[model samples]
Target: MRPLAPSFAALACLALFSAPALAHFQEVIPSADVLPEGGEVNIDMVFTHPFEGGPVMEMKKPVKMGVFKAGTTTDLLPRIKQSEIDGKTTWSLETELVEPGASIFYVEPQPYWEPAEGKYIIHYAKVVVDNYASGEGWDELVGLPVEIQPLTRPTGLWAGNVFSGVVLKEGNPVPFAEIEVEFINDASITAPNDAFITQVIKADANGTFTYAMPRAGWWGFAALVEGDEPMSSPEGKDVPVELGALMWVKTTDMSGK
Candidate 1:
């Protein structure tokens, strides 16, 4: 007979070590959700496991970066500056908010090769910033290949309020879309386990989903969908691409009350 199989403890350790990592979020986080009078906007652009807050993956220069406002789109890629997070390449930008309305900033990052998943990932991530207290244009569609159209206002939200949106693919609603919600773990909140690291939600027949944020911080919602076309990987194998439509929102606390 062959040698005895590994013991239960040995197998358990092997399985645990071989488990895949958590989901990756393409983050487009503005320093603030609401720009006070005479305030400017600064943004952090990164790809990482938001809730775990580390081992940030490298992000190449974005393919597209722009702001949509008042029926016009302006290219903002020129303002981006190279940076690093946790020894991984990242990017940042700062822009002055001259107009007194909501500006939607979005980015299309270059295809990232994820070796563990054996696929390329491209997330079209965006965020809304209300300037000078003007609440207009927060819901405007920037016309990305994939995106989340907010049914609820994306800004000026309070903690514990429900955030809702419809997942759209090429301007049409995607039924039963899968969304993963994660918060930037800046406050040292620990998850009980891997399952609680990222909260998963699914859209209904009309592609609408909602979640009540329990904390005051920046939250990232990613709508994941399979790409129609496949891309060739470095190993010369054709692999599926994971296209993500991601959005970021911030919630405030009621401490002053």
Candidate 2:
């Protein structure tokens, strides 16, 4: 179904609307696994928020992995997109990190496809049922995983333009390495990362910045090239991320300025 490069036309008018495909994501899956026997567990799929006041998480599908074997039937493998930026709406699947031993992972599903409820909450979330259910890992007495719930459907945030910045290298200021911005809200920042607040801005002094998310639904933003220092996670898996995954931007006329 590859027919969208007419320059994308504002993501093909938000993919021919009618609504029913909301999403928000964040699934790292390691849950303290120390499987030394056949040793092979290193899932790294991140996109977190709740206001990444010290951020760094950029996603564009390529973190493929879905191995649910034992009798076989769940091996949705696909990964390898490399890089993406400039009027976004990406997905290039064909991944397989191959480690089909003690499996149970279904990573990769959130890039326009919602229907959990309606109204947009976190960017794109889907992974409940104990996160994937298996042995409960590292011995918590086994019985903990499925609890990924937050998809109040009704998406279509940036019907036209979006892009925000702050990622330097030779000029400094590269905190968390991922600045894909373009918001429009005009000095009213407060939607830290319910993932779809649309626009919110701040950053200056050669670091550069911009914002204008005056009202849109699905949105995107990620930063933290390890600059501006601040990072944490390890308190109960430290889950408090609001924004999930809504990265797509660059469509002009932003309504008026």
Candidate 3:
């Protein structure tokens, strides 16, 4: 029994070190994924480890922020309000819906310097809200440097439904791209291990991937790839830039009558 205990301790140490690295996600969650009829939506912008739900990183004013609807894009940067999440800088925005259609909100954040990784990260994050039961144009592409065009309608989804998307970079499909998926822990779900915290999947040769939502909540999918060129870090050394195509989708529970 004594020898077994020591052997178990050694295995635990190895498990801790051998687990795959956890991935970070840029969250653009809204107060509601579906806009009420003629109502407003509150949006929260933050850079964080979503599943772990702590150590929120500082996010600067976005390089670009806007809403796309009915084939026109409106700049909403001035409406964004700044606040702190866990003492780290965060942002929010509010917008009212005037018509029935799809509303796509996007943010191109300034390149965030990650000291631990010795690189810069720029995750172009976006979320879609269906307005008044009209699912119009939920799949519109905003022409981001990297983006996920949802094959599945991003809003008004139900738990256990499968969500699918194509990972695109510069309007071209990225074959077999690596994607990381995590759900916001607002429900306080405890992960049994590190692997349960962040789920990973890969796009197929055509840059498409699918994930089934096991629970009703907000889920983020981030397709990650390296940029073509390096950028200068704050310390004046050139560092690799990681471009992430991130999207947030919400799912609901089936109503019990």
Candidate 4:
């Protein structure tokens, strides 16, 4: 005799447990974190699961992109060019850095609809590039709606260094905000389990959090907060929106000559 079919609830539970929980990271990575002599800086922006390093999501043209340096913000939206990775849409920009200070590159992408979560995602991502290793302007704020203000210098760090930041929403500290950390896996390392993919932490009462980098690579810190109002989904339904303020920092190992 044939076995009885499983109930709908049982199948749903199985599917939920079987799927891996991979956190989404909006990556705005520069070719070099510290340009000693001030040269061209190539920036790549992608929306994907950074730890797994694949299954890239299509990123629409960003609404705004620019650089903040020396108390000024320069628009770089027109310089951004469309690209594709694994058949998914991405973006890149190249700009020459002539100054001797830190340049904070930022991008505000269009809202992406995620049907599975029943919410839209809008990640305001940014990174810092220190020209001539001047070290100044590394702590300047880009004034994003939801932003991670770095307490530690965002560039020229050794691999084992601790990176700290404060979560702010609309220029105000967001106490106990949740932050997700992930490394840009180069396919050289493998996670032992799904739980090891994304590292989760929460800010303190003052909205500050810290994490240490174990290996030499780029790491992203995303401070997540829910939007004030719901947005219209593709299906014409009202859904919640997830606002992620992401920042990327690069670390290198101390090598002997």
Candidate 5:
């Protein structure tokens, strides 16, 4: 009898990418960041296949990374909990049966980042994320409440949504405020979602407003201009506006409240 060898595609995928490049029980990449106080963290994990020669291969596969509030069995917020961990800050999602590729994780900003940002720590271990050509993989987990607690301070936000905010001009709320936002994947700039953005929203009669949001990404407030003019608020001129999809901007003094 003859022993089986390997194929070009099989070898190309490499076992490392399929397994998060982590050891039998160790972390490969531990990331952290500076976050606002009292914010939640939403983690986004992406998988890529690295090659021995040439560049790393990007694989768009069905991988799940879930988060559970310190202690509970309820469905995690992002509900991608394919990996099970010991406590709140400890977890390992699997890319099992993966075709030898790499994975990326982005812990989005909440109201703050102290929870899992630079303060907490994470260890890596591989788990199996099953896949089926048929769509029967749905958990049918439904709305069963399992009593999950919110992390005193969690990390990550909606994967690619933008947080809306407003500025004012001459003691008046600026309607057509132009803002710049950058979409990022892990550390790379993702394809922009400007096409999905809506027109400027207005403040209510009370000088208050609710803003719209784009999916989720690394966002930076570019400018606050209305119809080609920059806006000014009593607080000061254009200030640094960095918001995640779950944050809100307050324009109090300019609203004449």
Candidate 6:
């Protein structure tokens, strides 16, 4: 009986060590969330575990990339350039903002096949950049198949501000959707354990979720929903698709001069 007890303890340890990996966020981050006078905004797109800040997955050229402003969407796919980080493929875009309005930059990346999860991942990620400090047009939707419509202004936020948004699938609210939140750790912070890597929250009956930013950096909120159709894996097996509507927000710390 003593030997059996030791074996049981070993199995328990293994289970703890093999806990599920942290959440993956498709990051579409801008160099500056607010442009005081309208200038060139450099945007970086990456797919990786944001909290751990490592093991960056290879990102293929996005199928669609554009900017929505003033009730119109302009195709910016031609501006996208292939880049690399830690030898993994990423993307970058530099666009000039000359108008006084909020610009919504969005990317629809190619589906990534994840063998560990036995599924494909497609994250339609977007971020809001205010040009000339114009407050209008921050709440306009980019019309992504899945998206987060920000109830609060996505830009010019201070640390500790509660950011809120609603999960939308096909332009309709998805009741009680599951959302994963993560910070883009820049090596200045370390997680105490795996549990702290990714924070999970659920939307309310109206499909709205909110979280307070504790630090000054980029934060990602991903509303995950299962796709309606299954896609074939590279191995020719039918696998489900995980559709994520991700939005990026930046927070700044208030300092006394």
Error of 3 at 125 (Å): 0.4
Global lDDT scores for all candidate models: 0.92, 0.34, 0.90, 0.94, 0.26, 0.93
Model 6 TM-score, 2 decimals: 0.94
Tens digit per residue, CA lDDT, model 5, 166-225: 333333444443433222224333324423222334444433333333433232222322
What lDDT tens digits, residue by residue, belong to model 1 across residues 91-115? 9999898979999999999999998
**Which lDDT tens digits does candidate 2 get at residues 78-184?**
44233332333233323232332333344544332222332212232222122222323211111112111112111112444333444344334533333333332
lDDT of 4 by residue, 163-205 (tens): 9999999999999999999999999999998888999999999
For candidate 3, give the lDDT of residue 149: 96
The TM-score of predicted model 4 comes to 0.95
Better of 2 and 3 by TM-score: 3
List the candidate numbers ranked by lDDT, top first.
4, 6, 1, 3, 2, 5
**Off by more than 4 A, model 2:** 1-46, 57-74, 82-144, 148-215, 219-257
- Ten-residue region with minimum lDDT total, candidate 6: 1-10
lDDT of 6 by residue, 153-249 (tens): 9888999999999999999999999999999999999888878889999999999999999999999999999999999999898999999999999
Q: Once superposed on the true structure, which residue ranges of model 4 sit more than 4 Å away at CA?
A: 1-9
Q: How many backbone clashes does candidate 3 have?
A: 0
TM-score of each: 0.94, 0.22, 0.91, 0.95, 0.21, 0.94
Q: Write one digit per residue (lDDT tens) for candidate 3, span 132-166.
A: 86878999998899999999999888999999999
> For all candidates, what are the clash counts?
0, 50, 0, 0, 27, 0
